[model samples]
Target: MIPNVIRRVEFQYCKLHFLLRTRPLSHVMYSGSTGLVTPVADPSLLDCSRAAAQDVDGFAIISNFVSSEEEEQLMVDIRRTLRGRKYLYDHWDGAIEGYSETEKSNWSESNTPVIQRLKAVAAAAVTDKVVVPLEQVHVLDLAEDGHIKPHVDSVKFCGEVICGISLLSDSVMQLQHEEYPDRWIHALLSRFSLYIMRGVIRYKYTHAIPTNENSVFKGERITKQRRVSVISRTQPVHS
Candidate 1:
């Protein structure tokens, strides 16, 4: 299988890695302009609700989740939080080397006031579900051409519902499951938007942001840009 996407690398930093589409050596290589060949997805697995898009199992994509002014404030808070931290260039792929993965952090959630507002929004989104205590906060600073490979968060480090707020750019989030790994639902995540993936959507399917993916928002097709994603997960409260 081959994907026909081309990436124009805007920035390449130390230890920063990019995912290039490739098949195992077992498959013969013959390159041409073939279309994206993916299996037909099960309709039951996808929920494309655009207006504050959400699914029954708790996956959500809320446009304008926060206002521009609020976004600016959040960014300021984030910059402050990241100002004195040291980031390692090595990508953790559950291995030593050769694999480049997303740059991540678990320390930002506890120090920011903006996180409190995001917590409230999550509570309101899933009214039936109560917001639990904040677990580890995962932050990713991706350059214009940066993106994530498809994978799920380890339950050991997180809990049921996961919420993330996008800042500074718009991108498409691709979701898929083990049963239909080849198929995906490309959802648009606008800047200042909040998206939650939970329940079956969280466990059954893996989510990713592709480097070259384009999203249509306000009827305009826009390319992916630099992004700062602030992610939080819920922790099971033990009494």
Candidate 2:
């Protein structure tokens, strides 16, 4: 079982622009360039008020999971490899679909050296009982304001454990539990951060990034920076 500090956190407000005022609790605020402000409530103090209670979802966000140097080099390689490649869509793949704007996929199978490095890192990161091979990995690129609607990965295509490594800029991912539709979890995925979702969190939840605004927090609307995500799965369908 994960420790108490690592438990799930629930946020009171879901709006892109809102302030959370809780006395005696330290708050961190992120300002977007569009003059929108999102106030991050103190998770520790969130337990006090019953009225402030929100749905709790099992999603883990680990900031700075990869070193800065590693993230930079990986992104550089991704850009170089994608320059001349054709982007395609396979309906059989469930994580993403439909007329999405400015996005690319399937770098995990590319011959780029940086992609090779990513495979190495993913292999090393899977220390659990389930060993996920590199062949099941998938890479994605999202442009500014690009959004992916809420959807769950097909059970057959992914492992029991799913890991997403963020590269460049930041994004707010919203997740909802199928069993508890009322409650949702919003996470700020920063550059080099890794988010791991498993157990009920893995199979029972739907996740997506919103497309309306570039940044969720006020005054934080910095220009959209190209972003990449390396998705690693530990449980292969064939094995």
Candidate 1: count the clashes: 0
Model 2 residue runs over 4 Å out of place are 1-57, 85-136, 212-224, 237-239
Question: Model 1: per-residue lDDT, tens digit, 1-239?
Answer: 01111121112101011111121111111111221212122222233444223333345454554666666766665676567554433456521112121323332332343454445433433334565636446667766766677788777766667778888987777677657544445567767766767666777777777656444433455688777887777765344
Clashes of each: 0, 12
Location of the lowest summed lDDT over 10 successive residues in candidate 2: 8-17
lDDT of 2 by residue, 1-239 (tens): 22321221111122211222221112323222222223344352112123213323234454455566667666665667567544333334444432222223344322233333333333333333534544645667766546567788777766656667788877777666677656556667777766656555567768776664644533344333656787776655564
Model 1 C-alpha lDDT versus the unseen true structure: 0.52
Q: Candidate 1 — which residues are off by over 4 angstroms?
A: 1-57, 84-90, 94-113, 123-131, 181-183, 213-221, 236-239
Assess every candidate by TM-score.
Answer: 0.60, 0.58
What overall lDDT, based on C-alpha atoms, would model 2 receive against the true structure? Answer: 0.50
lDDT of each: 0.52, 0.50
* RMSD after CA superposition, every candidate: 17.1, 12.0
Candidate 1 global TM-score:
0.60
